[model samples]
Target: MIKRITAGLLAGTLVLALAACTATVPISPTDSSGLGSETIHVGIAYDSAGRGDLSFNDAAGAGLDRAKKELLVQATEATTEAENDQARAETLRGLAQGGSNPVIAVGFLYATAVGTVGKEFPDTLFAIIDDDSVSADNVVSLLFSEEQGSYLVGVAAARATRTNRVGFVGGVDVALIHKFEAGYTAGVRSVNPGITVDVRYLSKPPDFSGFGAPDKGTAAARQLISNGADVIYAAAGGSGSGVFEAVAAAPAKVWAIGVDSDQYASAPEAVKPHILTSMLKRVDNGVFQEIQAFAKGDREGGSKRYDLKVDGVGYATSNTALNRYKDDMEKARYRILSGAVKVPSK
Candidate 1:
């Protein structure tokens, strides 16, 4: 009886969503070309840092690419402005109504917007990365165990520091950002408990530009360095690039740990070697999986959390970049996964 009711409900939802297809935004030339016979249109709204950050946005886009090539999906990018979290959500809704197959929203900025849109289009398979939780039945929220990966980064920053003082510049002060900060601080303390960590955000409570702006991010990093932070962890996005620039110009013993993707190669040559490691948030993989599930009729909505156990998030030390620290990073990774160490989160 339960299986029969479930089948009926799903069939009914698909019917309703198809009726509302007229409400979605129109497909553009960029999204139309290269679309094959088996293609499914996917909308990816990126963070303010934009596509070439060589970081978070690029990684998420890779996942969409995987879905496109493997499953013949079509991808379109929707860029967001600084502090315009709500507007981004509306944009996601527009893409869905426009007949996009499975829309993926990157970052925690889309959480609330996804929640609202999920309710409006019950049959739309929406995938939101970086954060989770959905009130609707058809929305799949892809969240990472960022805390676990952050702990490894914290250790890297501490170990790389010459002054024994480190800094953390966060994108925002929300719970999700806080998770990064808290886990990082705890990880550093585990390596050297007395090391002081100076924490700062780009904005206060609601605004989220601490991750977007390079100028402000550079200024904050400079201040921390001036105050004796020899190493820093940048959970801020484009803002983090600023920290890299500041470190390059600074005279002190300075280095930075980048977040989201493999940033060693993305950084300028001046500070390229100074890159300790990167916190890899597998945003793209998560999105690709959800879209594939939809294509195979296995899409499940609501909140979803992917952790180190699932390779959702972790820190990476590339042999091409940080050969010296590769072993240390591996040790940290093993410790976290083995449960010998527990990383704290907010």
Candidate 2:
């Protein structure tokens, strides 16, 4: 049975801690034969943004930290430099070769790498986040209903907007981000059929630098703000920081919605007030549960989905600004949970 991992506040500053570093740093290995060892060494290969993205990567790191503290597991982490399949494969392969069992690839971009490396190390179990296309006996896919959470945040944005216009900024124009856009747009429209929703993507596929480019995120937000959008939701990973900056600098009051984590807690002091809410994807829970399962000797592999039914995806309400709309959002949440409202994932 799939278990629910409780979401908690991350302990640390929210700044992009490793925004520039991009090299593989291997940790000392433990017993390679995970079967008979008292301690298990875990390995994680993050996407280009790495540990300090303050969004996706940070969530994953939180889980790793919890495992170390509670499960007593040793772990080594690496970030992809070139963001290509070759670099990702090498990172996974290196970790497996170093005796790190149950190596994890943090983003869907590592799908090809996971498939390639999982075959090479059949004895070592593997997990990949955000993607489940890989078919392997030793690999488990950790998937999430990102669209469901995005829909909740979209409702929040629609309710908070003063101009009756909202905006969406995506890091890349990929199918994954598309799910975010689809649900968010639907949520906004559900509140008001005539609301104007501005959508922009920082970069398209093949040039995924948008995920790490704050400058681009700022530019996108500015454009939306100029178009009279008072509430903006950013699913642009690290670029979401730029969206918050733009909203904070806007002449009139505006709100920015964050993705993946409780960005209000991590945001700078000045920007915190402007953040309405964030779509909580609960990647930390996924990471922590996977490690916990492996530690308990559950090696079965396949696709495991985290959806609204499992409390895997939802909206954060840290800011008091969201308190006023709590009932509305909660009603929407009930509809989603009851399957009365089927959130689109396209």
Q: After superposition, how far is residue 125 of candidate 2 from its true place, in Å?
A: 0.8
Which candidate ranks first by lDDT, i.e. highest? 2
Candidate 2 lDDT, 174-279, residue by residue in tens: 9999999999988888888888989999998899998999999999999999999999999999999999999999999999999999999999999999999999
Model 2: CA > 4 A from native? 1-37
In order, what lDDT does every prediction score?
Answer: 0.73, 0.85
Error of 1 at 44 (Å): 1.9
lDDT of 1: 0.73
Ten-residue region with minimum lDDT total, candidate 1: 14-23
- The superposed Cα distance between candidate 2 and the true structure at residue 189, in angstroms, equals 1.4
Q: Report the number of clashing residue pairs per model.
A: 3, 0
Which candidate leads in TM-score?
2
